[model samples]
Target: MGETRREMKQSESLQASLPEDIALKIASFLPVGDLCALGSCSRFWREFCGSDVLWESLTRQRWPSLNFSTESSSVDHGDSSSLEGWRDLYVKWHAKMPEAMLVVQHVNQCAVSGSLDIRDFLKAIKHLNSMGLGFKDVEMFLLRPEVNVLLNLVGLHYCVHCLKVPAEHVMEALRNSKISQREVCVKWWNLGRLLFNGFGMRDESHCRLVSLQDLALPQDNQVLAVIHRGQFTRSFASRYPYSILLVLPGLSRSSQVCD
Candidate 1:
């Protein structure tokens, strides 16, 4: 028994002493479950398995559908440490639902067309909120251009159509508004040419559609400024018009239009 234990210890020591690059390369090809199980080995092996190089390989293997360039967000939060970037991506991948994916795709379509209808925005928000992301997490994620465009559309929708307040103050004002008032303003309104238009169906199809230009109140520049102030970064504002057309509504309505 003593001789057997000694040989086992020597084997482990030899395995541990292998050059780290070689060990990581061997680990990179492991199946996901087996790779995670390898963490139960030596401390060195565990750390090696956790490296971004390996996880990035794993992420690529698992979710070929994701936009690797865009899906990667910094998981490291200061000295607190975090999983490798690809591992963080992996976690989010499994957590997403089909409904959420559908809503997000719709939001992407809305962003491109600059034709965000309030009902669709609200549905996206509901799906996003169900994901249990904190307001701060959402804010941080918005730094990504794709994410920023989607949420900016929602934020703009809330600012212009949901609340009479300006974009910059939308979130703050939303917090203070009474629950009853919010319910009223946030409901899907069925605007008709007149009372004779008949009691319209109150379904998703009946939701009002508005563009960023139509909702840019007081002045187009001012609305854009307010949107910039809300949560968007300066770089995003510069790119917004070309991608989202927030400043050009293709409407002849008054610039002072308010909800």
Candidate 2:
């Protein structure tokens, strides 16, 4: 215990001799972990290492893509005037990245399979939620081009029309997304139009019915028989683009349109 105390005192004396400006300058070059460790020495060291300049440098080094000034403004990131802002942002981003990559990899695998499997996708969502990433993290993950491309391919564009997928798969995705029901309903409608109009599909009954159900409002199941064979005329289809929207009263006019 005596020797340890002597060593600690010697270390503290050496660090104390360095000018504060020089100490902060040197800290800027240290890795985040080293800076964190150095902060444990004393209150002065903790305050010195917790400067915004040092944490900003560390944050940029760790995540080069983050434009802290602009992106931080859009989110409710507390205390941008201090090091807490950069430190907290980096911690959240770093913690979420691994799980986000895992989600991308799973979606890519599904894309490769050329089918939308509800069980597999639901399993991915469950794993993502288990990782403690909240709705904001999931939203950011979807914005990533690498993840978004794979998701669009397997989730909407190709897989929606693939014979290997069924209405149940789309319904399951809608149920598990954790986003707004209206967003999920719009996604299904967009996929159905892409599959039917752009790709020359003769049937959209299953996709449309699943989309209507995604509205989450009670609807007449008897309507299923009305469109079971997708026999609605072009005029009716154009006039009533989405029967689901009729039941939703508070949404804006623009939100109701699939376009």
Candidate 3:
């Protein structure tokens, strides 16, 4: 009984000495496990540590590309009947992070082995989709420096080198990639000599979805001329007549040059 009273008095003194904002700032620096433990100390600390604002900041810091505004707003407006608080959301996402990381690891392993499994790559895409991510969100996530490198390497191997993965699968992944397209194209362009040396254009569909503009600098006209004269074929030229005319010096839309 005496010890309980003493502990209560100590907690009360600490609460009185520390302003709520200062306490929250200090608490924000705590690891998730430490923060949860602190919340168990008392009702005041529990509510303080579980503030949606605090948890929302933490969640965003951990997953910058993810949007939790809807969930956070619902919790803030006392709509707990439908949506969970940011703390709960953070815990849920944190718990599932390992699964997401495992998918990334699987992709990394495939890239390292120089044999990308379209199934594993598709699994990663499916996982992102299951998380309620749209194409733009997926593109942003894939653009993270670490992820971008792995994605490009795997793409080059599967799409150009091995040529094992199907064109549809490649297109599916590309649809979710925007900035990463340039690196993949540059890689493919560099390996053009290899393709010309022997491989030839066995499957034109493999690169049909690739953006020609991404293959070189916007001002570099050589890429368009090379595509026009290289293995891209007349159909390829006709399909990108606008892009060709924009880059190629002598070509005009009225010239019927692409035709």
Candidate 4:
């Protein structure tokens, strides 16, 4: 009789079932990549991926790069196969009710080695704007101008682990990146890395974000600007002589870019 009662309880629990709405809420918070993987887990996830909210979320995630369908033609992405792979993955997850990502990812740093034209710069921004996935795993190759725009749109509060580029490029990039945000922080910008050439002063908005951790900058005038403006102390500024330092006149000399 006890066994029968236990079996009845199990049967009742199975009959009640979990609600679809709860399942969807759980899936929405998962990263897009994870969703894509989960979409293949079984038929159940494929349906969840079809949700419009997910596509909207993905669209917001990859913006500017994948913001609109028309601008897509201009993207100088390498390898048609890769494009298809990303698309296929998108389709596998959200193809039923198509949407786009806010930023594009895996842009090759090697691609922007020689020239830093506005056309190229804009295209790079467009690319980053199209990345529909989260920024956690993807590595990007940005020109100085695009980097500025990236900082503005992605918000200075973003979680970035690295900011690599050449010395000259950082100067121009920092100059032009002064549009909308503040608080500067760069991480692991190598000594030899280069930035785009024609960057103007960035918006005042960059003043709020502060200090990059593990920053590796070149020793040059650009570094001086970043230092003088950022008000890096004599000790900190001495370390990075080449990379650009944005000015945040309000912060104390003791505050740091890496901390």
* Clash totals in order: 0, 0, 0, 73
lDDT by residue (tens digit), candidate 3, 1-259: 9999999999877786788899899898887789999989887788799887788877876565567777666664455475567888877776664454555676666545333333454455555545643222333344334464445433323232222333344445554454334332211122233464676554322222233223222344343334333333222233321121111233333324323
Give me the overall lDDT of model 4.
Answer: 0.39
Candidate order by decreasing TM-score: 3, 2, 1, 4
Kindly provide the TM-score of model 1 when superposed on the true structure, using C-alpha atoms: 0.34
Better of 1 and 2 by TM-score: 2
**What tens-digit string does per-residue lDDT give for candidate 1 at 133-223?**
3322332333223443345455444334433344454344333322111110111212233345575543221111233333433544343
lDDT of 4 by residue, 1-259 (tens): 9999898777556634757788678778887679878777556667666665675556545442234454334333465543332344344434422222232232123222211222222443444334332232222322223443333323221222122234344333334544323333322222232448755443222222333211213432342244323332221243443222344446553445434
- Top model by TM-score, which number? 3
In model 4, state the lDDT of residue 196: 80
Q: Candidate 2: worst 10 consecutive residues by lDDT?
A: 182-191
- Report lDDT per candidate: 0.48, 0.47, 0.49, 0.39
Give candidate 2 regions above 4 Å deviation: 41-44, 70-83, 111-259
Winner of 2 and 4 under lDDT: 2
Candidate 1 wrongly placed segments (more than 4 Å) = 1-5, 68-73, 76-78, 81-84, 97-259
Query: Cα lDDT of model 1 overall?
Result: 0.48
Best candidate according to lDDT: 3
